[model samples]
Target chain A: MKLSCTIRKQQYQFSSVREVLGKASEEKSGDQMSQLSASSALERMAAKVVLSEMKLEDIYENPVIPYEKDEVTRIIYDDLNLTVYRDIQNWTVGELREYILSHTTGRPELSRISRGLTSEMISAVAKLMSSIDLVLASQKMRHQAYCNTVIGEPGRLAFRCQPNHPIDDPEGILASIKEGLSYGCGDAVIGINPNNDSVESVTRLLRMTHEFMQRWEIPTQNCVLAHITTQVQALRNGAPISLMFQSLAGSQRANEAFGVNKEILDEAMALMLRCGTASGPNVMYFETGQGSEVSLDSHEGVDMQTLESRTYGYCRHWKPFMVNNVSGFIGPETLYDGRQMIRADLEDLFMGKLHGLPMGIAPTYTNHMHADQNDQEIAGMLTALGGANFYMGVPGGDDVMLSYQDTSYHDDASLRELLGFRPLREFEKWLEKMGIMENGRLTERAGDLSIFD
Target chain B: MKQIDLDHLVQRVVEELSKKSQEAIPFPEEKELGVKNPHNREVLEQAMRRTPARIGIGRAGTRMKTTSYLQFRIDQAAAHDAVMKQIEPAWLAELGLPELYTRAKDMQEYLMNLDSGRFLSEESVRWLEQNGDKHKDVQIIISDGLSTSACEACIPDLLPSLLQGLALKNVSVAKPLFIHRGRVWVQDHVASIVRCKVVISLIGERPGLATAESLSAYMIYQPNESTVESDRTVISNIHRGGTPPIEAGAYLADLLADILRVQASGVAYAQLRVK
Candidate 1:
């Protein structure tokens, strides 16, 4: 009974650990499973237990819920972001920090809180905070923002590059990789969006990319953007599985497209915890866009931005490495253009950050979306100034396969120069070794094409 | 993501099956000729600001303004040019890309007979027999479909990314070829001649006043004689003004890889059950 209750508490965050534990204490007999199913609050949430119907299942296991897990989901999806953001609009860093901390029980140990403001609020706050007090805010945000790529600690800005190759072309891919590294790309991780949808193709690319990174002596990890099952299969097959990746949206039908559900996600999270490239438990990378829910047509009457926030809520369970908000990638039918994109980018960042996600801003744009690199760069700048946890290090800020322009190596350098942010720690060492970085600064020769030659 | 395409597929199926059947497909709801404003005056202005469409333009003494009239004339002229303009053969020659012509001999003939625009000429077939090599796993065909400007504008940025991405995948690619007057279905012809796994057709989209230089990439996994229309997929609205040319090229690399791996394209690939 205690184990089942604990599982229910973790899976169905609508109820608190206190509620589950409190109810568990009400049972006269320790093994009384009937008493466990009696609560109205739990009846709705009990379905989350995978073996709820299995009368003889081993429901009793680890009943100890971690401190961070306890508070990972609280006051989320309550239509609370705007009210809370409005309440704290004028509060100072210390005051706002204290209020947020007070709300979360797992303080000091866990760096992020799962419940908080929307990206809409964050972007507005970003613009408002851009000119006033960036250093202190960034410091606080950095402290609480996702993983610190330097080691696995929080504070330092994390980043990754996706050298989107056509389809398993080693020469072309290596050229792009060399070019990216020459320009000092690949801070958080170096991943590829494999064009092939087959699981075998993805596994091959993951293995190949991992070996390439290791051979190059680059500290960053690698991932192959493939279907969820393909990634899971690769994990079991002894293929180098970096952070497992997937494009997630709030709608059920959206995930159904990729054959994913909460069960699959939780299962993948479990598998990656065992085998993924690890500094710690966090080893998932999720890409999300605002318009995806509506784009999938399973919006369930929820607005796009709200649905996007719910994706983070679902993601927090895995304690992901980062959530890349693809604000402008969807196009005009959803967001229309640059102005809407800018707003959406801010909202995505704010919400993800609020939900305690290690948030990265891709600030992507496509020609079909009626926007360009310039528009994307502008959005990146705003989000960077807002202290987004990380940014994309794609080649030339262009993804050949995904068909969107994000932050390029030069763009990262410019952001660093303008924003005073540095790459993750290990990548910083590699940069210094290559003489691309000196005294934590990009040299004049930073993007010289001669490096590749 | 493949998921979006699948979800989009399901929704499209429902929409197609449910809509009242007719001999001709209607222009989309958004493509109606006149302005329809039911929102408040202030709200209408806000809506107009968000889109490029000419909306919220109040009547000028019950007649359109000179500025609006001039703008309409400009758009109409650009549309005319988009349809009539021919992609110079010299353009392809300078790029050192291989070139070909469809069976269609002229623009008027091409317009009148869609079938003529979708097949290669006898001489073109002979040329392919000599030059076709399976060294490249993917074949790219650049064509002037409905808007030549789109073809011209996208080539500079799109080609490098596509080639670079393909090279990264180490997927061998044959020398790119062009079509003087081609349609989306021409890819089947290219694939029939070239024994490659995939054929990508970068063709000009139907030009609109909003943007003339927009391109579309029509991809087929294994185009052959028995290929159905459902066996094709596309990434469209590509240009500096739509989906960036370079980005689209890179995206195609990944899509091609997917097509090759799954050995399927279009509706089948999207609906393919992932293991």
Candidate 2:
């Protein structure tokens, strides 16, 4: 197919589909760090023009990383529905973008088409969409998954109450959990990132959270975001685990760096199904970001955005209950500033939804990056408007242990009010019974942790 | 009314306003609970005492109350400023530290480009070759990493105690040098030049809303091309709020002595100790 285009009398030639995809992507510091981004604004536009004319079959035939060498590529190809692929193989990337945004393309048609598209194809079309384009297209597709409580149902939003502690103090963690619950923020899960990753520490934190949930009769899940192996040992030791957590990368080498493999994940999922506290099918919670592969030095030659999509492809294998995309978590070296962070958030939300996963946006920023609370709020609002399934609820938007900022309990409550949404069905009832939430709004008795006393 | 009387009245109002402004209410302390009329205030206060996470801050209709909102902003602003601010040159000179620089030309380059902060400049390399103390048992490096405020706050107290601890142990320590806009990996380069067995880098951490003066020490034993992240041992959150600088200094010295004895650092050291 054509791989060259002339814009403003400047002919730009791309040698491969990988080159075109990288250059056509929006400006990102990670891609620039790898020296894969387009050199100039005009050249970027030229690459996008060339990519728009390329057919779906062209990208399908040429994966960025070859299928034989990469497990992520193999998993994506192995899981594709070839029947659906053959029907739309000849459509141009430009046509695919329009079809996704068309008024008639509802959730059913989008879901059917999603099974055919590879992760590369999803990344390709996302490069052509603007901020609003990503949001509008993302709004049409909402994928639901179930654990103890249902996630991603229409007109319902959820929050993972991330009550992290710096020293793995159980009493401190329980206190934060109480505070989050009073704000009606713990519908998705009460996931804690422990400073200590030992099996004993993970098991202790899990037991504490599980006991607290039971004591309050709260309709939620409890998770300790230690390494998957550590969680497995904890589970074997009889700790109550509601959701299994792991940080995923797009490539095999990067996954290796993270000390995870497909085999390990498979065994973990089987264990969760057999003995975990959560009910059925979706028991995994994954956190993915764009620059992880590059930072780990495992992104062979692919762009950050494309690698992130491949991560989603690998993630959907477990049928995760929550896929939290934390694009700006690394630093300015990856996202550069608020604009880039916001862009990555929108793109990740849309891509995860297109992959038929229950997606959440963390919309996080570190202190070193040139981002503040305003930029994070903008991302949270835009993704919430785009029908994101869930978000993280840190206390006052600060994670003391992780040393980053995420959506806070106040932001979580405000998102529901802004979108006229409610928490999960069971959680809303619990909040009403406790006099914390009514008519999808927090009541007068909310925002006081002592109410639990 | 007469114009003169009106002018006098306006002057008196301005003076009264200035006096009232000068009597400004002190900003609310972070420890003071923000929740109003809790069901059990004692329980809320006890919970607030447990963790530094911002809880018990009552909300205004699904938003932070005005005082709490401003407090969060002020803390965030301090963190941002810490990353952007530079360590004072006069202070570095006062410590008798020979200054070096990374390849980064400015703060923007250092923040955005990882490689720029990973290696020394040509001038710095030559300066080290000419003047650096070589073949020592340990070489210490101080860098103003993400937060220069951290270095400015902790080094004066931390450095003296660390040197005293090392001297008491009779460790052959090289003169410490300060590197501007450098990351943890720069210590490897310094080690390669000075030919030290153990190299330690006391660098600033990315400022969090809790404290901007936090620092971290990354120690590596005989860094080579094969050295991975696990080869380096890190002791983080060295600040007044977390681990006090003076205490971290003595602790690091003792840890260095252990590393020298075991011939390892990081995971290897931990494993060997267990064995």
Top of the candidates by lDDT: 2
Expressed as tens digits, the lDDT of each residue in A261-337 for candidate 2 is 88989999999999899975799999999999987777888999999999999999999999999999999989988
In model 2, residue pairs whose N, Cα or C atoms come closer than 3 Å (at least 3 residues apart or on different chains), thus clashing, are none
TM-score of decoy 1: 0.52
lDDT of 2 at A348: 97
Candidate 2 stretches with Cα past 4 Å from truth are: B1-14, B17-26, B29-32, B94-98, B126-140, B156-177, B191-200, B219-234, B246-275
What TM-score does chain B alone reach in each candidate, compared with the true chain B? 0.78, 0.90
**Per-residue lDDT for A346 in model 1?**
70
| Candidate 1 B-chain TM-score | 0.78
Task: Compose the digit string of candidate 1's lDDT tens values, residues A283-307.
Answer: 7888898767554444444346545
- Model 1: CA > 4 A from native: A1-140, A143-155, A448-453, B1-275
**Alpha-carbon DockQ of candidate 1:** 0.02
Tell me the lDDT of model 2 at A441: 85
